[model samples]
Target chain A: MSRFARPHWVEKMSSGMAKPLIGEISAALDTLAATGVAGAIDLSGLPLTATDRAELEVALGSGEVEAKVTAAGTSEIRETGFAGVWWVRHFDAGGRVLAEILEIAFVPQLLGAQGDDIDAAARRLRTELARTPERETGRETVHAD
Target chain B: MQIDETTPNAARSAASGDDRTLGALLAARGVSRRAFLKYSSYLASLLALPASMAPAMAASLAKAQRQSVIWLSFQECTGCTESLTRSLSPTLDDLIFDFISLDYHHTLQAASGHAAEEARMQAMEAHKGKYIVAVDGSVPVKDGGIYSTIAGMSNLDILEETTKDAFAVVAIGSCAAFGGLPLADPNPTGAVPVTELVTDKPVINIPGCPPIPEAMAAVLAHVLTFGILPELDSLGRPKSFYGESVHDRCYRRPFYDRGEFAESFDDEGAKKGWCLYKLGCKGPATSNACATVKWNGGTSFPIEAGHPCLGCSEPGFWDMGGFYRALSVPTGDVARIAAVAAGAGVVAGAAAGALHRATKSAARGKHHTVTVEELEEK
Candidate 1:
């Protein structure tokens, strides 16, 4: 009875949230496969116990692709063990999580560079290329025009 | 008088006659799509909307016009305004300013005297039924509202006139939502909440001593994205934020369930962060986002700091009972005598026991069932 007491503590800590959330993720995965429409679940909005969160993390192991986006603040987008499932977390300046979500998509939208940014990058590259000296040293300089 | 505009982006756009959609405005300002995505996700989470709604919300917000807002302050302290300004950081929350054209505000606006009043009137005339009127204080109606007046116009008169053509009304604090402290005991001013006067428009109440800044921001964002108010509870509060009681989300809930309560402020249980329920915590009865969204940027709430919740968001919180009196204990002579005896250190245990027995006996006798209709009538 004394040895079983330890396991009871673990059970007491559990909010019984991880199992249902995993089921939701599976359903979302099925939806994504069938209709090519991505789904997302806001983790921050739910009242997840610490033990439940740990269990969720253990279930959704890390995958290959991992990307960090820096805009107003930093954001981490990582693929989970499931192919179409990704874990996205946005952090404030103080590194506190502002929002977290489980995204079911081929690729999370934040990872892609926007068209406006691409256009701005092109103009910036052109300006930098034009500013380069024609014959400063041994390397040949290419004109932007 | 000078008119200070705090929201430079919206003001600048309005000044330049740039009638482009919000998406175009963000692009013009070099705001990246990633930032918009992040903000949309945050807003969606705050509003308790499904995560899939982030993209739709972002798209809707981008195409939406800046919402016109007219802020009116009446019989209350400036704590609500102070809380909003101080708690909203320059991160995603500040984007609320860019989404709304705050045509008139007493505290945040630079205009004073006739200039401020004229601006409010002009905004009302220009936007008509398209503008939102946000009020932060209770309206005193005693003696024709002579207690509080602005520009020789009583609060009741102003609230009635401003809300006549408004799209919606937002009661920003407990004062404006539930008549708050001013309508507590004795009721000298005959104060009443915004819902009492404005029956025509949708009145959304964000009832807190000072509501969570994020909640306020999220409500505005919801309006901007959906062109309508969020789902409201019976008390006219946003169900997303006020759906759960503070005790339900409190960190010390386990201690409460385990029957490990701190009997005193400096006890061993107190040091170990046990429950404060015995110390008159109103968390069990109070519904607000304080325990979750928190104050000072998710830092801590009153219960987290070892203080009992005052149930500030509820109607008539001030007159409910003594702040240090437990909810189970009935208010009036017995509790008052117990408190006085305890203070005097004169047989405190006996007084407490008597009080407990009195409460038990009272409970046994009073089997009156209160119906929803009866509660509503009260």
Candidate 2:
């Protein structure tokens, strides 16, 4: 299932629009960024391949956005929009993963028997993300003149 | 694959006197370096050590021997044992045999009754002054200690007998550490922690409802290798694992700091995995490795599993209050205005009162004012 589909239930209760869900996703990514989870994944799965990273270069160019093969599972952020990756085994693709990503994570230190580095990375990434200047998206001012 | 060698220098000298690398050291002792290093690296991370210490730890581990452990079950459920035995990674047996020798665990051992008592006695005698004694459940000291007994002896007597010559006494589970459910208010059993009963020996209390299995294993390791207990907090819990509050390490801590809280169980906060403190999460006060170490094989914990903390590790946790009652935290700068307003009101009232007095005094002090009015006055 698509990652957005989980939180999209809230959107179903909306006026049949997905903007609320998208907003939730944005907030979730922000929180994750504050926690050192910096990248974003598109759950619609456009037949992504090893080379598709280059094909989605336009999306990747957004600076806040990055794409890679996340471990198959919903990253639940709860209904505003977006999903949190369930385990770090998926984040094997993060920070430049290697071949047999599954093997390296399953080696016991990553997530299975013992948890590793998720806390430090989350703190570091989130602090760094919070400091970035807002990428203006036209709603900068709705002030009452 | 389990190298139970405890002579670092011997293992080194034995391996052609080459002192570098777990590869060479374990190879000298006929243990696979990969397997040893693999476990060592995992243990190092569990202790929150940097990646650089992996080699040194592995090398030192070549001489790490399995200390004989006699598991003593006291007045309680077998949850702690169950938590350890069910570990999914290397498995708890791997921990028991590979690291420390579990000489006699009543639940896991095949022997029972007279044979079980004999085994425990032998373990204490054979490994005398060197064995590790792990106690689960609390010791009921009331009514002549008749509340719980093993082999016709009260738990208090058994603990005293078993721990008399032990290297270190470890209190596992909340029952043994902080007196689990049996310790709740109006404790008829008069349950007391092992630390209360064992005054002669050093006791390490791993006090959770059931402490994370890795935490249990880590304590055992530090005890075996260093021959010194890990630095413990004021409550006798090892600082490496119980140093910080679960809330401090929780993933939802940010939401909490921002003044957001889960208002209800099934609300958006639960879905967002936001802070559950407002909903009476004891993470702020209770200490354990739950947030980062997690559970269900390091996957999640009570908060992540969408439950508030019951404060199982803290003393008098069961009686202090309900799990859902918001702990009375200082209302922060948010309520500072009340005091400020109070001060302002006192000053304002005094000023008003003083102004009236001053007006009366001026009239009384008047020398040439209102002479005609004085004449017209009756």
**Most DockQ-accurate candidate:** 1
For model 1, how does the per-residue alpha-carbon lDDT over B253-295 read when each residue is reduced to its tens digit? Answer: 6666566778889999989888787787777667888887888
Write the residue-wise lDDT of candidate 1 on A30-123 in tens digits: 9999999899998987767567778888999989999999876889999988999999998877677888999999888788776556776788
Local error of candidate 2 at B1, Å? Answer: 28
True contacts kept of 1: 0.49
In order, what are the TM-scores of chain A for the candidates? 0.76, 0.20
Query: For each candidate, what TM-score against the reference?
Result: 0.82, 0.60
Model 2, runs deviating above 4 Å: A1-145, B1-31, B91-96, B329-378
lDDT of each: 0.78, 0.57
lDDT of each residue in A1-145, candidate 2, tens digit only: 2111112222223332234334544564565657743332222211122233232222222222123321211111111112332211121112211111101111222222211123434666998787654533233544422
Interface RMSD of 1: 7.0
Model 2, range B212-310, lDDT digits (tens) per residue?
887888888777556788888877988878876766566666565454567899898777867676677767657787776666555567877788887
Give candidate 1 misplaced runs (Cα > 4 Å): A1-12, A114-145, B1-16, B329-378
Q: What is the TM-score of candidate 1?
A: 0.82
DockQ of 1: 0.33
- Global Cα RMSD, each model: 8.7, 22.2
